[model samples]
Target: MGNLKLFIGVLVAIFIIIFLLLIFLVYKNSNMKKNISFLYTKNIELFKANNELTKDKADLNRQLNGNDDVFSELRLALELDSVVNSLNESGDGRKIGMDKKLEGKFVKSIPNGVPLNFKGITDNYGIRIHPISKVEKFHQGIDLRASVGTPLYATANGVVEYSGMTSSGYGYLVIISHNFGFETRYAHMQNKQVVRAGEFIKKGDLIGYSGNTGYSTGPHLHYEVRFLSRTLDPINFMKFNNIFYDERKVPWQALVKAIDDF
Candidate 1:
C-alpha cells in the first residue's frame, strides 16, 4: 500500500513540473512576438524618414538650378550695360567708332561692327544643343546677351528687305540688304521694329529692341552675316576698331573693283 501511495506522489510531481514548463513556454512566445512587433514599427518609421529626406534633396537641387539661371542673366545684363554706356559717351550721337579710311566707300556698307553693345557672345555660329529643345543642331548666327528693351542698332548702311514677325523661330525679324552681296539679319526683337520694310537706313540707325521671343531661353539678340546667301560667322564682321574683311569667304577684290568703277 505504501509503494502505491509513493507512485501516486511521483505522478503528481511530474504533472506539476510539466504545468510549470508550459507556463514558461507561453511567456517566452509572448515576449518574442512583442519584440517582433516593435522591430516592424521601427522599420516603417525609418522608411518614412528616408522618403522625406529624398524629397528634401530634390527640392534643394531645383532651387540651386533656378538660382544659377538668374545669376547668369544678371551677369550678362551688367556687362552689356557697361559697354553700351562707354560707346554712347565716346561718339557723337549715334556715330560709333569706325575706320576713317572706309568712311565713304562701298566697303563702308559691310556690316563690320557689332549691332548690339555686348562684351561677349553667348552662342557662336556652329553646332550647339538647343536650350529649350535639348537637341543638338546648327546655330547659324551669334547670340548677343541682352535684357528686354535693350537698344539695337544697324551694323551697316542697308535697305530693309523684311521687317516683321515670322513663323520661323526668329521672332520679330529684320533682314537688311547691303552692297556687294552682303546681308545682315537681326532677330528676337521686341514686338514691332522701329524701321519698316523698304526703308533706307544708315549704320548707326536704331532697328529695334531686344527681347526673349520665339524659341529663345532668355533675352538676347541673334545676329547673322550672310554673303551671297550663304551664312557666315557674325563675329568675324564685328571689328569695331578696324576694317576687317574675310578675303577667303568674300570676293573683296571684285567688290572693290565694282565700287571703284561705280
Candidate 2:
C-alpha cells in the first residue's frame, strides 16, 4: 500500500486540526457570555443610581430641616409682635422692651409704676360733636391737653372725695376716693394748689392744677373715671393702664390714648 496511504493522510490532517480548535473555543464562550451579561446590566444601573442618590440626599435633608423650623417660628412671631406693640413707650418705634414668653399671657391690669401725667389728650369720651354746642353730646370726660398749672397727680391711693367748685359743674374739682371702687375726677382746676375734702392722697400727690373748668372746653384737663357708679373710660383707662411710675422714661404716648389705643 503506498505506506498505508501516507498514514491515512496523516490521520486526516490530525482530525482537521481538532475541528478548528473546537470552533475557536465556542466563539470565545459566546463572547464571554456577552461580557457577563453587560456586567450584570451595568451593576443594576449602578444600584439604581446609588439608590436615587440616597433618596435625593434624604430629600435635601428634609427640606433643610423644614426651613430651619420655619425660620425659627418666623423669628418668634416677630419677637412677639415686638412685645405687643410695646404697649406705650410712646410709640415711634424702638423701646419695645418686653421679656417675652407669650402665647396669651400678657396680663397687667393695673399697678406697675403709675405716674400717668399728660401728653396731650384734648377730649375723647364718646358721642362727641359739641366743641362748644356744635350739637351731639355725652362726652363724660377725658380732655387732658394740659397747660395752665398742669400738676394734677394722685391717680391711685386716694380719699379726697371732693375738693372745690365741682357741685356737678366741676370748675376746679378733685374727687379721689380710690381703693377698688376707684373714683378719680380732677376736673378743670387752676385756682391753684388745692386738695382738701378728707385728704389722704398718695400715689404721686399733687392732685390739683390744670384748668378750663367744668362743662366747657379750651384750657383742658377734665379726666374722670368712676367704676361702681360706672363712668369708666378715661381713654380706655389710659390705654390699658400700667401707668409707668417711671420705667426709665416711658411716654412715647405710652401705649394708647388712642395714641390710637392698642
**Best lDDT among the predictions, by candidate number:** 1
| TM-score of candidate 2 against the unseen true structure | 0.23
Can you write out model 2's per-residue Cα lDDT over 70-95, one digit (the tens) per residue?
44444444443455445335456544
When summed lDDT is taken over every stretch of 10 residues in candidate 1, the lowest stretch is: 239-248
What would the per-residue lDDT of candidate 1 be over residues 1-262, giving only the tens digit for each residue? 9999999999999999999999999999999899999999999999999999999888767655555654344444443334323343344565444322233464357787778776467899989998878999999899999888888888888899999998899999999999878999999889866999999999889999888777888889999999999998887778533222232466544564565455
The best candidate by TM-score is 1
State the number of backbone clashes in model 2: 9
lDDT of candidate 2? 0.62
lDDT measured at residue 49 in model 1 versus the true structure, 0 to 100:
96
Model 1 whole-model lDDT (C-alpha atoms): 0.77
